[model samples]
Target: MKIGILTSGGDCPGLNAVIRGAVLKGIKAYGHTFVGFRDGWRGVVDGEVLELPREKVRGISKQGGTILGTSRTNPFDGPNGGAHNIKMTLVSLGIDALIAIGGEGTLAAAQRLSQEGLKIVGVPKTVDNDLAATDYTFGFDTAVQIATEAIDRLRTTGESHHRCMVAEVMGRHAGWIALHAGMAAGAHAILIPEQPVSAAQIATWVQEAQRRGRAPLVVVAEGFIEQGQEAAHSGRGLDTFGRPRLGGIGEKLAPEIEARTGIETRATVLGHIQRGGVPSAFDRVLATRLGMAAVDSVAHNRWGTMVTLKGTSIESIDFDTALGSLKTVPQERWDEASLLFG
Candidate 1:
């Protein structure tokens, strides 16, 4: 069988590991040939491809990002889009199956395409760790580690200047990143989208921390909304998918925190830093295992399913099951972290 693979949505660490794992396992175990689609769905729509031989995947497990590249391109849009066109393209390339490595949006698209008769297997790839079907996803650990390190460094400066420090991590609809990083960094306050927090309450926490002769450290998810305040709009505008560009939450919150608490506050948006660099050992192992499992799914003809992590095991799940809802930070987990807050 000939398989095609593509990475979609936001770029992340361990993407290359998935590609390498799939190619190595598929070729050695099943003698299946592979082709990589460039720039996500746009590559399929435009028929852009690159050959994926076993030698091409060597030494990419520690590498970040995808060698085939990625984009937010929706395969159903544009002039040469739709199921028929994509199917025709695949037929022309002699590709029998597709291995899509991406987040919710990518998996949802693959689900729709599968319904339209395209054989596709999904591999969940979100740094937010928000997918409901999986206990955790690759890239989430690396992102958390990065954010925790940034907060650790920021704490020193905050203590020296006796100023409040606000660090922002990525989490669109879930608070996993902020919650984990905040707890790991011993933040005085942690804010997330799931739980809207008032500025006054945050100020109280900051003041309490100051009263204890400690510099306040607040960790916030980018999707976190302040009570009674409108969401901060990014100057960068929208992407091809029509979703508003997310950012500026930390920058917007910093001044508000300073104003309310009467303390100097600075915001550091860990923007793309969390997604770059070498994959953590945990992420590499998980991504590689999922990648190999994806090929096994393909061999078994398990189309329209995604590989997921359930505890210490790798499993396959339906796309709808995975994309049905986001795996948000539970209230209990938040409450546990809250116990440490000022």
Candidate 2:
């Protein structure tokens, strides 16, 4: 069987590991040939591809980002979009099955394509850890570790300067990264998309820190809109590829908190930093497991399903179930983190 693979949405650590694992396993175990589509769905639309062999995937397990590249192109968005033309491209390329690795949008696209008669298997990939089915996605742990380290370093600078350091992490609809990172770094306050905080509330947190003569550290998610300011006419709904962006909440909130609190505030947008560099030991192992499972699923002909981590084992789930709803940070988790806040 000729299998096709593509990485969609934003890049993250452990992506290359997934690719390497799949290619290595598929080639060794089943003798299945593999082709990699570049720039996500656009590559499929344009039929731009590269052949993947064991040599091509060597030493990519610890590498960050996708060796195949990625993009946020949504084929289902417009009239002449790439989604409509994918079938013809697949036929021309003689590709039998697809392994789509990405976050929500990528999984949703895979689900729709499967419904449209394309054989696909999904691997959940996100730094947010917001997918409902899986116990945790591969990249989320790496991102949190990176964010936590950044916060720890910034804490020293913040205290030395007596400044309110606001470090932004990535989370679109959930605050998993911010919640875990902030708590890990002992942040004075944590803001997340799940909890839209007001300027006044944040001001109080900063002011109290000032009163205690201690610099405040705040960790915020990029998608955390400040109350009514979220729905305004802004470009917060598009990705870097200019397809429905999902950032800028911390950029907007940082200035507001500074103005309201009268503290020397600064915003550090982690942006792509959270997604780059080497994968953690945990992520590499998890991604390798998922990749192996994905190859096994392809062998089993488990189309339209995704490989997910359930408890101690990797399990298979329907693509629709994985993409059905975003897994958000629960109130109890938020409250637990809140206990440390001033």
Best by lDDT: 1
Please, what are the lDDT tens digits per residue for candidate 2 over residues 98-216? 99999888988898888888889999999889899999999989999999999999889989988889898887678899999999998878988888777788888888777888889
Q: Can you list the residue pairs that collide in candidate 1?
A: none
- Please report the TM-score between candidate 1 and the true structure: 0.98
Against the hidden reference, what TM-scores do the models get? 0.98, 0.91
lDDT of each: 0.92, 0.86
Q: How accurate locally is residue 335 in candidate 2, as Cα lDDT from 0 to 100?
A: 88
Q: Write the per-residue lDDT of candidate 1 for residues 99-190, one digit (tens) a residue.
A: 99999999999999999999999999999999889998999999999999999999999999999999988987899999999999999999
Please give me the total number of clashing residue pairs in predicted model 2: 5
Residue 288 local lDDT, model 1: 94
